[model samples]
Target: MSIKKLQIPTYLSALSVMIFIIVLTFFLIVGKSLLIPLFLGGFFAILFTPFSNWMESKKVPKILSSVISLLCMALIVGGLLSFIVGNVASFTSDFDDVTSKINTYAQRIDEWTQSTFKMDYEIRNKANPDYLKRVLKENSSNISDFAMKTVGSLSGLVLIPVFMFFFLLYRHHLTQMMIMIYRDRDPNLVKMRITSLRKVILHYIVGVGKVMIILAILNISAYSALGIKHAIFFGVLGALLNIIPYVGPFFGVLLPVIYSFLTKDSLFYPVAVIVCYQIIQMIEGNFLTPKIVGGNVNLNAFITFLGLLIGGTIWGVAGMILVIPAMAILREIFDLSNTTKPFAYLMGEEKEKTQKNEKPEADNESSE
Candidate 1:
């Protein structure tokens, strides 16, 4: 008996795959509104499942239990938003002081410009005194369009909780449906696959949450020690933004640094803010993430950065938030197939020498 190779001819297969990808991308873009909400709903549903299950085990009705679990999630999100808004409102209440600081900074900049460039700052200002006003007047329609888009985005936020509630209510049915779809595979293997996927998604989300909380505490302590006002607000906001990975830490630090400079008499305070955040971020990147998140997602730096860029391009902030989990899901799918396992290996982190040698070394020791 002869074994048959499973290879398809290159060009025809490649063309078919390319066409499929194009159609998939088209639908993704066109159906983003419907899809984005569903994805977010699925995400929160997974997070809230344990609470709902516990309530059920205690003989609570499913609908009521789901409502209670959802309320818990809402309160947590609402508390964070309220904290941020309160701090911002307090800062804004001192508007006059902020304007005075801005004026002082502008005057210093003008003076430096005059001395360094041998130009009269007043003459340059006179040349463009109405330039900003003229530009704003011309772009009034664009401003209106942006405002409209923002309002639309906010309204979409309402649908998320509704979707999440339903997802939680029907989670058991959904799990069974997924298993049914894989009925062609071995029953035990399909069950194992579903279980593994659930565990990976839940573990990744929980681990990331733990890391964020730890960072928030560290950030708050550092800011308080530096005498920054509204330390908790800045720290929490920064920690939340840090979820975006590489670009996020820089932006997280930038907000506090700017606030310190604008609100303080000395430039040194802003510098201190930057230095403090950098140290915390360094520790977070090297220690906290590895220990907490471990190798759950196992994606490499290049792939991660590339995912961020593509995600940002496609769906803005929502894409960036959802992309890592999407990658994890894709990696798991790829690993399940012998033909696609190589792709999964590529998505994973580069192999460390010690890890690569461990199996061989163990075998050698055993033989000895």
Candidate 2:
């Protein structure tokens, strides 16, 4: 008996995989420079869309409105930068003292371990000191490199705002172009998808913005009450870091903890810092987010954490901050197609009883 031969497209499959890997690597290398600005521009454009629409309603020219919006953003950022610059000396001094205090704490820990555990201090210190020093050196180098690269890139492109201005100026045309490109057969479906995406992105921007503001205020108030040095600096830092989700809160708390440890002999200060962060996080999770973001875009905690992790791994802090909004947008797109609707359901906000109870009008119409 002759066995039937199996025909496999091995070469094609291998070639496909290789091509994908190469493409991915190419994007990863260039994405830092290109994608960051593109994404930031896109997000800002979305955030400003409502204002643009409002301007149009008032009979403002799109170009003028776009310019005004960009100007407003620049002024806001410039004011924040001025605030930071004004307090830079205090922030730097506090940070340096905090670093010294952390080193002292480590030394104390080493002594305690030697006394209690009867460990060899010299051997342990020798084994770990070089490793810690090397790690710190590398981290410092990476930070410096990143700063230089960012500044270099920004200097090279003095025309980004010009690009953004045109992008926003022709924003309506861009949406129309997208619809024209994709809506050959089903205009209604394409329109629905666009509508959903706009809603998701808008809600996310507004919600996250409000949350950050609240966290900033809470941090500032708590640090002021504790009499921590550079309270404004730490508050602003916390607000910026809060954009990074789960890991952000830990880093936000770290600055104050280190400052408290350095400036105060009492351990209560550190404890108070931790308690304040926990309380603020609780308030954010329980009260502020629900009210501001509403229940329209509920995400599962585990998935949210996973998105943060994956995004951070790929694009560092920026990716982590963007992941939820990206996920929301993706979910909306997936929900537009019948084949991918299940995936959307998995990612989307849980439906209320009233929404669930509503019969499908399309189904009823079709039956008639």
Candidate 3:
């Protein structure tokens, strides 16, 4: 007689998966302090892989090659960083003007509030013209606090370069480890996924970097023509923020417009800045990004926006920045198996692209 198989209830299995996801999310939120640097290092490690390979092709030692790769990365990063810092220092040299203007605005707001709401004399009297200056001076210590809370604030960050070094050094071994984790599956298939993952990640990072450089140059030129103070600083900063996808460019332009509104005599400068930024953004969205990045990530707009919101909520700006690559990598993983193929579809633009392709085919067939 054939033995009856033990069948699990479908609802139970679904519930188990739900519980697993919740538990996993909790752990991710809690463990981000440790995970953030490691994740960053792993990605940067992937980015530097080609450079390290090139070094190895020249008969360089593996460890030495990794070191050389890190050095190269450091030099490029340092050059850009130094430029930003120099511009920032120049910008801050005019801090008193900006601060004084802001103080004037704040005092006006306070007076308006006092009149509009009819607050007690105590509250009204509390509004000193010098209150803003006093608060800024008193809270000078808060600058350190703010820095300490920044994305790279954690002490674990020091290990990022270390992590990158070891990761690059043992890149092959890590790939092998990933393969071994799925050793039950076809090794070749697993290896293909790994290779694709690395390629997609590297392409995305490099493409984004190239786009940022282009944007920065374009922005600096435009801002200089408009005579925007701190042109270099704002230009580079806005470019840095463009890594966050859609929302970043908005805030990037908003700052300069607000400053111009407050500082400049005529409203023309602020209005011109807005018009110029919108024109640049139009070109960037329509031509530059598509031509450069070429939909390698292949994410859908709805999902991308949702990911930005969820990422920003969870880990702030760093999350927003990292979520794109993270989702792309996850899609690669999901694509590895038949069971997960639906998830891969959910994450990718394959269906949408297919629909578009079919429309033209249908038109041609009807015409024929």
Task: Report lDDT per candidate.
Answer: 0.80, 0.72, 0.80
Clashes of each: 0, 0, 0
How good is model 3 by TM-score? 0.84
Per-residue alpha-carbon lDDT of candidate 3 for residues 1-368, written as tens digits (9 for 90 to 100)? 99999998999999999999899788878877767778878888999999889889999999999998888877876687676555544443344565556556566667777799965335434545355545544554453344334445657556667788999998889879988998898888878878888999999999998889998998889899999888887888788889998889988898788768667766799899899899888988999888999878989898899999988877777678889999999988888779998998998887667899999999999999
The C-alpha stretches of model 3 lying farther than 4 A from their native spots are 1-6, 95-148, 350-368
- Candidate 2 weakest lDDT stretch, 10 residues: 143-152
Q: Who wins the TM-score comparison?
A: 1
State, as a TM-score between 0 and 1, how close model 2 is to the true structure.
Answer: 0.76
- Return the clash pairs for model 2, or none: none
TM accuracy, model 1: 0.85
Query: Candidate 2: where is the Cα deviation over 4 Å?
Result: 1-29, 85-89, 94-152, 155-160, 185-189, 349-368
How should the candidates be ordered by lDDT, best one leading? 3, 1, 2
Candidate with the larger lDDT of 1 and 2? 1
Give lDDT for model 1.
0.80
The better candidate by TM-score, 1 or 2, is 1
